[model samples]
Target: MLGVSFLPLKELFLKNFILVRDAHIEFSPGFNVLTGETGAGKSMLISALLFLGGADVDWEVFSGQRDEAVVEALFVRKGEVLRVKRTINPEKRRTRAEINGSYATKSALRERIMPLFEIHGQHENELLLDPSTHLSFFDRATGLSELQREVESLFERKVELESELRKRRKDMERLRQIRMLKEYQLEELRRAELREGEVVELEEAIERLSHVEALKEGINRVLDLLYRDDHSAYNKAYVACRILEDLGRFDRTLRPIIESLRGYGAAIEDSWRELVAYEERLEYDPEELENMRARLSFLRELEKKYG
Candidate 1:
């Protein structure tokens, strides 16, 4: 027969566990047997006790209906109470063990509290194999020696959010570098001082000025042909008009021809005057042309360098 100290559990408190969200229960002095139907949380309570005794609990065993699950127990041995608490945190993928309201390790919890109970099941050895067995159940008839062992495997998962946060911090630095590079490029562009339509206007000015000598010669030739030459078109037309006037005095039908010839002479003189005015407007400044060429070359260099 087992003595009173063989069953050392005094009280247990569970919060946010699988089915029992919150529960408080007290055990008798000796040989406490939990009685309930098969699926009535009897096995879950045992698992909770094992978890309190510093045995590793697979994170998947919790229902995940809550963020955290807590299992605490009070054990009595020789008129002394051993209070142990275990907190499971799913988010951080970590487990914490406490003893008597102070933080403790799994080893300390096992060395102190595991000797209080005997656990035996077909798959139960899996949980006990880590440190040692502490809690086991017996039927009402204690003669049956059948044991079922359940081995629970557990692995601490890497918290992906923390990893992602670290990666995001690195990415932030990269983004900052890219932004600074763009700022430097913008500063270069500003220093260059580009104008919107200046390139096209300067190109056109260069095109007109490049052909200045040829245009001047052409305009002088036209002025000579119209007014300065000995047989200029304007003088020839005037002479023709005088002859027509004399001929029209003899023939009345020739009066209209005389009037038309005089009008033609007037139009030629107007064109001659306009040609002289146009010739005076032609200019070729070497310095201005050189400056324009230099400006165009500078713009081309800038395009090759930066664009």
Candidate 2:
């Protein structure tokens, strides 16, 4: 059998005033009794013990006297010294605990105190009448060990399954959001039908059209120099040829001039042919320009829709 022992309360109070001051009690391995007259602090001592166990206490017990109240207990259990301290303020009232004089918490104290001590008050008789609390009371009264083990095992399994269920629910919610975003992105990409290298092709076409005016002006200047009215290169070339032909019989230097005139005449003729071809290419096609404009407009609309 497991053994338990409790040391006496070192100090206790209802408020600033002390109730049980520096009191000590030692219990053996059997029954014990705490008996006193009514209103003689027997019930008060029990209440203090109850407070040490994780029970709530009413603030009215210390109403107008003082704001702070304290109760402290010492225990010697299994060769280890345990200290319990409870403080009550107007705003908060609970137990503070220590093991081997090291600071602990009320929950820690309760864990050690539960098996060592069990308080059965007069109100405990009411459990005999209540069917709900009856079975547990009988189990405790008879020390039914195996049933307690089964209940504890089932309780632990239930907690573990509940924790897993909560985690799965959170994972499912995260996956659902990810799937929705991917589906929307896929739909947008499908509707656009974006083709490879389409952007590069469109950019090249736009660059060519952007320099259209400059290209046309250059071509016109060349054409004018070759074939236009009075200052044309072709007219100048014809005049040079006539002068060289007249001087060719009179001077030897005029033979070189005649040869130069023939070369200039041949170059001008070739330039004239190239100029006609350039003029034909510069002629605008209305249908093709309209198609380019429509395609750019459609691309802009799609970009806006997706964006």
Reference-based lDDT, residue 136, model 2:
56
Model 2 over residues 72-170: C-alpha lDDT tens digits? Answer: 666653564566666666445443544556676666555544444444544564324545445555676798746875887798799999999999999
lDDT (C-alpha) at residue 218 in model 1: 89
Model 2: runs farther than 4 Å from truth? Answer: 1-53, 57-133, 142-145, 200-307
What TM-score would candidate 2 get against the native?
0.44
- lDDT of each residue in 73-157, candidate 1, tens digit only: 8877677667888988877768898888889998876755665555666556443464433233242235332332112111112
For candidate 1, give the lDDT: 0.74
* TM-score of model number 1: 0.38
lDDT of 1 at 68: 84
Which parts of model 1 are misplaced by more than 4 Å? 1-7, 122-307
Cand. 2 Cα-lDDT: 0.64
| Residue 172 in model 2: lDDT | 100
Best by lDDT: 1
